[model samples]
Target: MQKVTDYFNKPLNLLPNYFKKIGLGFILASVVFVVSVKISGIHPTAEKKEMMKIISKDVVLLGMMFIAFSKEKDEDELTMLIRMKALASAFVYIVIFKIVSDVFGIIDQELIENKNGYFFQMMIWYFFVYYSAKLLR
Candidate 1:
């Protein structure tokens, strides 16, 4: 037990698990969003804008829970700045990717059928940024 714990507590191992927590968070929130849609018997895509408004809050709560824990160890100011830059880039990329996919008509229902679309993309982006940060460091 001690050996296992010691191995993971290494800075390297801790990083992946931290990002994995982010993935789990997106999955949990997505499940709630999908289940809510099914149980409510409201599949109104026309009302989708309103639906997003309702569930948008869940993203915040999930972020607070998952991302808050990812910062378990104190980082140096330089490292923190690098992370902030990475986050900004991640945000821009998500926005641009979503827009381009929508505008170019490249995506279809399969990718987003159950709000899983958002969650799926989020997982991919988190890992991209997470690993990129690791490599940059």
Candidate 2:
């Protein structure tokens, strides 16, 4: 049990702090592009629109991954613990959300079919929990 705890407590090899800024830039650019397209009302063919959605989702997910794995300005044992806790909390939250939604038929079937949607939700939860924890500390 001690060994298992130690293994779980090991720090991840995160990206450099600068990558966080890069991640933020990616997210911001993706948002700007999406907003501009919506405002311009350039309705492409269905296929093209679907492709655009896929591309935008991929970009956002990539940015989120970069942010999730990036190092903090002052990485330490407490930070590592907080990160672990946040990730676990996010995972549990997503699982419960999925189960509840399925049981209640609250969300669209298409959303449940798309794994990326769940991933996006999880990332959102992770950031929320992480920052909230940091602020409280």
**Over all chains combined, what TM-score does candidate 1 have?**
0.43
Candidate 1 weakest ten by summed lDDT: 11-20
lDDT of 2: 0.88
Candidate number with greatest lDDT: 2
| Clashes in predicted model 1 | 0
C-alpha RMSD between model 2 and the true structure: 3.8
Q: Per-model C-alpha lDDT, please?
A: 0.59, 0.88
lDDT tens string, model 1, 1-137? 99999886644322433754774677577768767877998767767857675575566446543652355354555555555666666677778777766655544645434443554465456657755776777
- Model 2: clashing residue pairs? none
Candidate 1, which segments miss by more than 4 Å at Cα? 1-65, 72-74, 106-116
TM-score of structure candidate 2: 0.83
